[model samples]
Target: MGKYEKKLKEMVFRLGYFTRNWRQIVHLALATEHFGVNNRTYSPDFSLFGKRGPGKFLGIPERIRMMRARAFMGFIPLKDAVRLFPGYAARHGYLKGEENSGD
Candidate 1:
């Protein structure tokens, strides 16, 4: 691979490592508090994701896979997301804000 590609790959790997390690640390802390082994009482805030209903819990591997799939599906880069809408507008002959106009 070229120098730039190699550098980019290294950067991505470092970023992934940092993110994974951070999550693991957070999970460990949560688990410790969850089991009530700590001297202080701790309560988990589940309101962010809503109630934890019955379902298969996703471990780190599954979470990473899902993140990778989402990244591959053009979910990144807000600037590029606008490109996706132009084609549909061309096909329908509709400008963005003038959708209500008869013209």
Candidate 2:
């Protein structure tokens, strides 16, 4: 993104943090990165960025459990999810705004 775009994106993200309630914050966190994933922490049953939600691994229907995992990850409040799970986020090209927040 351009310098101005990055600034605008961050501005939007911070705005979300204020208006979103506690429950919404939790939903954003889970619906996006969930717990996030690393090479050491991932398996067939767990994908941080995929069509199937976590419940899908436990016999739940995909249609009922689907979440915009990657989309929600873009919201500013959850930006740190990329930093917290840099391995998978980096591998999946989720470094747009948080390019340098490596752990």
Candidate 3:
């Protein structure tokens, strides 16, 4: 019904885990391969409330919706988590069979 809800629906479908009916809630985590450091790190922002909500019964769908909304904001200027685009793409499966393809 809202923007976050809509985004959540799109992501769920994109990850190849779509549910046929509306009432059916197939709660699960997506396997995200983030592009960056040598140590592989999955998309940590997909959780219900990593740093947002805790002990909140907002439902799995709602949680995902919020996460999707935050993702739209793009990578923030976090000094600790920042990295070059080429390295990022390479780690995130965006590289087309080449190291640092974005370059």
Model 1 lDDT on a 0 to 1 scale: 0.40
The alpha-carbon lDDT assigned to residue 33 of candidate 3 equals 26
Leading candidate by lDDT:
2
Clashes of each: 0, 0, 2
For model 2, how does the per-residue alpha-carbon lDDT over 1-103 read when each residue is reduced to its tens digit?
A: 8988866766665466435433433333343333323322223453444335655345333322232244335643356555334545665677755555332
Across residues 11-88, which tens digit of lDDT does each residue of candidate 1 receive? 675566546455433433333323222222344532222223332243445544444344335654433322323334
TM-score, per-candidate, Cα-based: 0.27, 0.24, 0.22
Candidate 1 wrongly placed segments (more than 4 Å): 1-58, 78-103
Most accurate candidate by TM-score: 1
User: TM-score: which is higher, 1 or 2?
Assistant: 1
Clashing pairs in 2: none
Which candidate, 1 or 3, has the higher TM-score?
1
What is the lDDT ranking, best to worst?
Answer: 2, 1, 3
Off by over 4 Å in 2: 22-80, 83-98, 101-103
